[model samples]
Target: MTTTHQERPLAVLVGVQLPGVDDVEHAADLAELGRLVQTLGFDVIATVSQRRGALAAAAVLGEGKLKELAELTGGSGVVPSGAPERKNKARARRAAESGEDDEDDALGGDDDEGDADGAGSRGARRATVVAVDHDISPSQARNLERATGAQVLDRAGVIIEIFHRHARSREAKLEVEIARLNYVAPRLRETGGGGDRQRGGIGGKGAGESALELDRRKIRDRIAELKQELAAIQREQSTRRALRQGQRRVALVGYTNAGKSSLMRALTGSEVLVADKLFATLDTTVRALHPEVRPRILISDTVGFIKKLPHDLVASFRSTLDEALEASLLLYVADASDPTFRDQLGVTRSVLSEIGASEVPSRLLLNKVDRLSEDERDALRLEFPEATLLSAKIPADVAALRESLIAHFEASMVEAELLLPYAKQSLIGEIYENARVLSEEYGDDGGRLAVRAHPAALDRLRSLLAR
Candidate 1:
């Protein structure tokens, strides 16, 4: 009835409570890190936490705590000097040879477990990975790997891995690749023998570049190529977005696993990928609001944001986040049942601000209220008086949300009269598609119609009528 490390990769979570971070925030961050590790298929076995003014530059944890952490991973409980460079180089070369370097095999290779002396006698069950709650330096990661005898992944690494795995669209895949390459470029190490050199000089007399330098250069070149490809894809996306400029667009932006996808499915009736994992949906999916209201509202589900989302990913996914930036309205969704939903909402706002989406008109939607008790719901209502509290599962709640979306856009609509000529009767579909027809009267020469639509859409309709 129990799972072993062999069945699933075992991970040990590590956290350091720094200055200005209270216990609640620290605990929440560590819990989020555990979810991220689980998202990568790792079963977190234990957590090592420490309170310090700052994270230790060398090992991230104090000496005693470091050793304590090592015991759980069958390590030697000592941070050695740079003597393991040769062994690490060999491991890197083997990983490269097996094509594992380009994959999400950071915690692979069972041979790398156990103590540094190749002694498997440390009876404690070893963890295959150590996931840090905060971002650490490359050197710090290497030192921790040496001290704990496990693959080390900081918070950013875990998030990037999840994005890499969940990316489905070409644009998302390219963006994830760029972010992954940027992450790996700095962590490249010299492989092969310690003194082995690759030829970089014309005559071969001068010392050539190290394997590490070559790898870094390759990563840089690959990242550049990926960016160019991503740019091309983004150009196509821009064109498509431009076409939707006259239509009403409502974007769903929120923290990961905040039930955005569930609400998205309910409101739009689109079969988008819905899951209970971090970064489950990375692709930007645009679906028309179901029951399909006049002046159809295009609802977009963008990639969810998280606390400490990597800057590289933010920059790479800017095109994707443009869905939020350009929306006529934004729905800031959150799980009201979660105790940390407030913090999660703050993070979502911070990221939106970083992407310049803060100026967009938005509504707070506290989802999953079905899980909350009556007292909890009342407390939430008092705290967020203006927010819409509803669960995605309830049909009436979904209908209310859908109507609210329609009403929000309808508030800005202007009434207009269009005369559809008999010769251009085919244009009737266009009018019905772009506006809510209030009335229509057909005559011998043309049909007189009254409609309500956004100003931009009406202008477009007038231009089409003129042509």
Candidate 2:
């Protein structure tokens, strides 16, 4: 019963190409899992994929490959040099993957799997493993781990681990805890408490404390406490949002790790951590965009969106995402570098619609344009005529984005001609500093004042005229 995992576990990332899934979809699946393994401190040595026209219920990938992986034991629980003899032959097959292959194997008992390289040579054996496709059920993981003799992790666990690492704020940490607890609850049941055997009680108790029940109870209590604490934080967040009412707020929303924080930092000159990892940011950060015209345009850069984003995590972040909903504008950022940008766009759009933020006037921000050439940028300009394409790393691109935002003001802003009395001419000064006054001409009745303002502020000015 080994508790520690091998230092360099040989990994094979799996993705099954099923019907209705495009090639890029499957590629993203593989790429995301690779990133997840990196976060979990696992070395991905190889990849194993299959195009399953239909799933095989008995063994997910098919019986033949399942049996092959089963026999290898993924180099687990045994060392190659001390192995009995049969297990050493596969060394040549995986030579390319063994970057630092010392003769020493990480696992114990070389005799467990085999010995020598078929000619009685000696070296400890290492573990070659498999991380299977997204949506692998708990039963599926156990089945694969048993058949392949390799520990298993699905997409959700990978995502949860990334969230677990990135959550900085207390609220975010609790939200992640709640999601993790929920994720582990069903998994613990699926694995049957890791084959814990029941023991007889000294007092002749009818039922001893079962491992499964204890794990389940602990998860349930932790989830309850996390939820309670989250609720309290949500209350505080709600109040903070309420205090900023009436300002034209905009929220930058998009797929996870889609450079939202980078763009936010680029625009506001704020020190938001910009990382090259998925879900690098989990907390919401808001800043005022302009000091004049709009006076205060509160723009929030919240957590990035993701495909197959868990509903439980969504519900937990609803209070945080409410900031996006209350916003007057939505800035949808997309990774221009991703070949499947269209699909990513569709997924984010679906999430927005689900969150009830679909109706807001959203302008797409095609980010990472620095990765593209001039011709490529021009090509995308035609693809998204309405969106702004910019690279957060480039200051010039940030300036272009700012100019594009100001252009939005031109369409929504209203121009008004006002007749001000001589005594009320001082009121015009207030409007001059706060707004762009086009003209001032004295007429027979009074002085004329012409000004341009955004719709909301224009309506407020109209009300002031009545006074």
Candidate 3:
């Protein structure tokens, strides 16, 4: 018999020391896991991890450690100095039959062959689910599950869960569902490796009525349904894009929660939801800007980016992220207060490039400079010589933004004048709305007028020109 100090709702932070991810990132991943566990109503009282060589696989942890974790997660591991963690004495008795004796007493080591089934092996309420800090290959996930008595998932899966929690709109929900299904589909286990269907938990996991086959079928069907729904949504988005192409679209692109939404609201006076969380703005929001200052240059606020985003997920969200594709100009807003601002900038560019917006002309808008010291602000100006140093939260900076935008738009616009008869008052109205009016006047006969419009808006105003 043995006693184990068992903390309820504990999670094991597993890590595979892979290349391109340093120790700082490994720490960050663990922190993110803590946050997600909290969100899922689980308290992380401990983290168990092992480092292995770069070439080493097989979960990067040994089998003995796995067995130890399995016992604890299975509710047969030790607690305190001499007791089990099961609140239910009946459950504790149930666990004891599963060969949960102390390591010194349990057949000398982890290799002892003990064949015990059904009656007492399961003790933990939440079955052991393995969380890895790295990307897990499909085979890797399957293999990890076999090696450890738990369901396995990687960084992307946890992120998708957070996105699921934050998603609000139909479009956003569909996008998240599509991403989640895509991420999960390849990882779903077909074989009942742990035990059998009757021996597993729900979602075909941990051995219960919601068997592996049932879980696989649900995942596959959901994947099909989400694909169909996303395709339809993509078609609708395409239609809307055609209409918007008539306007010069400037998409505000940046890192997540870098005040892009706040900037959008400030510029267009549109009340978009602004929050402090990552990926707050999932949908692209377009706003009419510079009506009098610049013609046909509508501004859009798009979703933010993070480092090491899942490639398949990015590919799936390409349609929703069309702002980068359709954008005539990208206002790359960066947070001044971020310590890794340069690194984040690189990541943003990489993500944009992956989404096929590499050559798009971008204005580096260094936002939140109000939080910086004067010396720090000077250093930033030197770093980004062409970037507009401003605080999106400040009205003065908003004015500076407006000036920069007007300048950019005017630089792109081709000025042309068209003459219309006074009877074509409707055409004049079109000119006023679609083009920045330079001058308006009547002919000597007062039956005609002359107007100037930006070339970008001329296509949409063509029919009105006929009037």
Best by lDDT: 1
Cα lDDT of model 2 by residue, 1-467, tens digit: 87995565445566666668876677777777787777666666445455544433434555544543444444232222331212233443463365523222212224222421221131343335566666676766766765666777776776777788888999989988888888888887535455455654663212555667667877787888888888998989888876555445779999877899888887777788888877878899997664234345567898877777777788777877887888878998999988877778888888778889888888888999889899999999898898788888998888787767777666776788877777666677556544577888997778877877666666655566668
All predictions: root-mean-square deviation over Cα?
9.4, 10.4, 11.9
Model 2 weakest 10-residue run by lDDT? 100-109
Give me the overall lDDT of model 1: 0.85
Candidate 3 residue lDDT tens string, 395-427: 988987887777766675666656666666666
Q: Write the per-residue lDDT of candidate 1 for residues 117-158, one digit (tens) a residue.
A: 232243444788999998898988989998989999999999
Error of 2 at 203 (Å): 18
Whole-model lDDT per candidate: 0.85, 0.69, 0.66
Pairs in steric clash, model 1: none
Model 1 RMSD, rounded to 1 decimal:
9.4
Error of 1 at 172 (Å): 0.8
Deviating ranges (above 4 Å) for candidate 2: 1-10, 67-129, 189-211, 290-294, 410-467
